[model samples]
Target: MPRKFYDGPQRDKPRENCAIFGVACDDIGYSVSKLLYSGLIALQHRGQEATGISLLETGGNIYTYKRKGLVSKVLNNRVLSKLWGNVGIGHNRYATTGAKEYSSSYYLQPFHFKNNEIEFSLAFNGTIPNYAELMKKLEDMGRVFVTNTDTEVIAQLIASLSIGTEDWPEILRLTSKFLDGSYAIIILTSEGDIYAMRDPLGFKPLCIGELKTGKRNLYFVSSESCGIDAVDGKFLRDVKPGEIIHISHQKDIHSEMVLRTNKTAICQFEYIYFARPDSIIDGVSVVEARMRLGMYLAKKDPILKNSEITDNAIVVPVPDSGRSVAVGYAKEAKLPYIEGLMKNRYIWRTFIMPGQNRRKAAVKEKLNPIKSVIEGKDIILLDDSIVRGTTMRQIVQLLKERGGAKRVHLRISCPPIISPCYMGIDFPTKSELIAAKFYNKYGDSYIEEIRKHIGADSLLYQTKEDLSRAITKSENELCRACLTGIYPLKSVEKIREIEDSIAKSRT
Candidate 1:
């Protein structure tokens, strides 16, 4: 039997994959590490476990520096000064179930792969459901493995295909055919070129930008537009689905549409919770989408139509994650929006602390209610989503016991997540999700059961159709697999089936 490791308390929401940023400058005199640091800092919310950068030096040598820590602590001035290069790529990792054991520097990115035949550094954001199959094929062809990471499999596949030709776009096109899941990858090669590509379905966000200073032009590829903005670069546009973009010191920007599909399944959670509010992904503003979600929730709210509930109701957001939705809800519902909670910024990553009692105390340490504003009022609490129901239950208890609220009505911006996600987000097994468990037991009564479990007077969730309308994207253009239990990739669907059988056997 293999040893299994589990972290602290289950996180409240799904975790994003990783953050990737790449830069190419026209002059070798300009150092790119500081710029990479700034860009990665802007995307720190996506991942915070580890940070690393691989730079291409003047002599076509790839230099890598990575460690387990936040970007600021890992790539300070002293360290950035030593990594001199004109082109480079950086990564911030978010640990997943498959990567929990391999959290060392060896499993971190930018994963530098060098051999007698080729050398390149890769930074990636996403999951490969069929990576095990690909690994088996590679191993049969005489490739040794060091870690059980999809990133390593991806690098080895690209290296194997490079034997035929050095055309980056063509190589990636071949690579895409074998990979089945979400991915936005950037590679810095010894040939002094950077290749960035998005998966055919555009399941993750990737964008390109340009900056000019003192007659020198620099190009960048980042997981989000906010990253480009952080580096004082112009946000050109999003990297198209199945598009391979090549950036070189001597050239402007070259792109090719290697793959095409009638519909693209951009992750809907990016707008709901994952991305920064200021980010523009696939030409849609994240903040605006969230506002629309709240507005839609208010438009259909039956409680708002009741004069008694509306008389003393005050909208209170759960904190930063619920602020935008609460704003829209307040405006649409004609209610007063109050900052009823004060957040202690210093308290974060509370789950990492051992013991259930410690975790419970950490929540109160993280947020305290403003008793004066919320006391003796109908509190309308807004949050992004509910994962395992533990944290939300605690929060509802805090508001009533500590703040003296008469009644609490909870509104969620996203639909219930009833299935595990395989394309980057961290919920892997159906047994761990609150909604999945309730839905399997009570079916259509799951929402009522969840509301009762959390001790809320009423609970309302955003409908799947309304969520799509809020994002201004068609249902076919978004990935709602977590909500619908239908995956976009065949490989992911197969994995879900296998897990379902194992779960059934346990019952």
Candidate 2:
């Protein structure tokens, strides 16, 4: 059987950094390895490039297994059987740092660090914006670096701090002061304890869940609640921003607020695209938030209200991610919701494919028009968002030419992604964004210009206000940096450096 759930390459989607899962149980009766496997499976969508797990046995021994493959491929029955323990942590990695071409395995994580005093393994999700600076500081302190990843830098920092103190939470608090990025990390120590920490800004999501088995209790910490749900655990709540949760071997869970800030900057992309629709993060349902975005878009559409389009006009989802939004839009617009495009379950995500030719070919094989549903109809095509616009352009062409659609109108669920995401998302430079390019070329008429470029009769996006409202938060509380060009972190200099580098590459 193939390891991947979806075969075709992804189209116009931002890649997430990674997913982290950790669990601590009262006894060895439960298979902690198997539970970690289940949790990683639920988070497999967050990353597919690499998977790992670290287990702490009863006798203060820690074993780690990791490789460059999907979770399904890396953790087979034979592999899980060897990882016997009551406490463990797992990771699914999508590289946001380190060169993929140079010894990639060195960067694959559930990174283990050991010294005469302590031993611990870490699984991290999110990027460290000040990675070079911190790594240099550690290097100055005589720390030997093996891998080029920020995960290793963090592990070494913790090890250096553990020398003089046993208070892991205090060490983490001090570590937090030097870090400037988004991160949710799980640490599994040789003492059979697990520690989960989220960044001060709450740029990433982490949640806790509980499983009660008669006389025993099991605790889980994961990047998303869906990981807990996969193991049949009950979700307790999200770990507060800048909180350090320590789950001891005795099944005691304690939390410390190491860093306190007046505001949080949770990545809006989680609700827009990164997370599973079934998962809830920070007290909001991702699916419900997207549905609200569609409703808002439908309510504000002047064309829909004026009934200017043909009577046969229909709402068609781009498939998968766009399905919920299309349903919501159809409900509000009083139009029929139809699956006009059929996706091939066997094709791999196009974005992960190596070459442009291969990616294009995969896209062609991945989706085919449902002629009966789309022929002779005007399509209100709903998609999550457009990144480079290559996929959307091809999709628009396919719908109009092959599906025989009279006209196509594009509705995007979020505002124009005019800037790059600096947290953990893959859009590192504005030059790679179609919206940014269009805005540069067309000035005030970028929307209309992008519509023409995509061969759509009309193009509309959810306003910034609607997007914030749909997520049940004010714009000030969310990370609208990608859309508004306002970064929440003190990394404006780094953003400019990246933009400058990208411009140089293009020239």
Candidate 3:
């Protein structure tokens, strides 16, 4: 097994950065800044460290504004009123690379690139495992970069490809061939056009939509369908895995499927935890997928066969992310569903907190048991997945010690995560994952060991088959790399070798 190369405490669940959004209007009568703000707010759950936007004024230069704060705080009325444009792009970011503190604005997006050759604004989701190799290639060509981010490397690559042609789609097509990681990118060119493209593997989600207000038409590109709904736009469809979509004032929406592959590896975490329930990805509804995961859990649970446990038990979710799954479990098992936990609206998500102690302390501050509903009752607690097991252990203790529950049965919607992810999700190293640790030592007894470690009366996890059936995608069509130690990208495999060698050296 390999240890993490990065030095620091890590969060328990998978966290991804960057939600890209762009809007293009047919008329200048409307400013797109407010619409951009609304779209970002809808996708805010995807990122929380920073927010930014770049707007192209009609017959004027592009203006960029960004800072380290939430979308609501960073893009306030005082700031949005000054940013006037009919075409613009926005981004919400939680860093997986470069600086995590977000102290400098240059590290944020939409990365406004301005050089002697071209000018454009870029917003991006997903990670590039081969970015360092591409950066070295550009450095050899006499390109200088200010930030150590893949976003800068991508901008420089596009500039290099634009030396002979100004066709935005052609430039992006050439740029995509050089990239070897998962990404969904939207670019706003000075020509007042927005170009959106998904990677060949489709590791992230991107969609297009349109809206009509009076006689003007508006087109949007967003990381999720929820953003389009936030602006009252009707979702057209998801961008094809290797497609480049062009939205402009001069033409109907244009699309070019640049690269074709037989298999795609869409991240499975989108269905389990990442995306908003109201959003749909790749023709599958998020809420429906989660509910099906719960149904599967209910079908195979051996403990449910005992009438004594099922008789006095109530199904309870771990707040927002687990609510849909709890609903399905209750419906399938014929148990009463109860909102046994009350969440504090003001606290930040404990899942994203840095240290184990801080996250454990925040768990109590963030959620309190409704003692009246759960007292003297057997509780079936549901959550998305168990990562490091720190939070789950704390929550289980909280339920028994504070809520007076007779027994706590912990149920997880996804299978045990045994591997790290290189495709944007911030899963910890193999050594740090609780399931991975126990599996290495106990083999087939890992689940029982985990149940004992977390202080749960019993534990059950959704099988991989159930996960695939719930999402309605074949095993090859989804990225289960975190559940199984296989990577789809050659660059990520090489990265694994390097990290393994580093771990061996330290040992």
Rank candidates by TM-score, best first: 1, 3, 2
TM-score on alpha carbons, each prediction: 0.97, 0.94, 0.96
Candidate with the larger TM-score of 2 and 3: 3
- Tens-digit lDDT track of model 2 for 1-507: 001112223336777878999999997666599999999999999988889998987677898889988898899988888888888999998654434342356577788888788799999888887787788999998988887677888898888878888888888888888788888999998878888999988989999998987877889999999999999999999998899999875957789665778888989989988899999999999999989989999999877854658377899998887888998899999999999999998877655565567766767788898889898888999998988788888888889788998889899998999987777677635666889989999999999888888889889999999999999987656888889888888864576677689878998
lDDT of 1 by residue, 132-153 (tens): 8999999999998777888999
**lDDT at 355 for candidate 1?**
62
lDDT of 3 by residue, 1-507 (tens): 001123345567777667999999988768999999999999999888789999999785788999988999999999999899999999998765444433578888999999898999999888888888999999999999877778888999999999989988889999999988889999999988899999998999999999987789999999999999999999999998989999996674789655888999999999999999999999999999999999999999887999999988999999987999999999999999998989998986666667778787899998899999988889999999998898889998889999989999999999999988888876677898999999989999999999999999999999999999999999989999999989999999999999899989999
Between candidates 1 and 2, the lDDT winner: 1
Where is model 2 more than 4 Å wrong at Cα? 1-11, 96-104, 308-310, 353-358, 495-507
Q: What is the lDDT of candidate 1?
A: 0.89
lDDT for model 2: 0.84
Error of 3 at 459 (Å): 0.5
In model 1, the worst 10-residue window by lDDT is 1-10
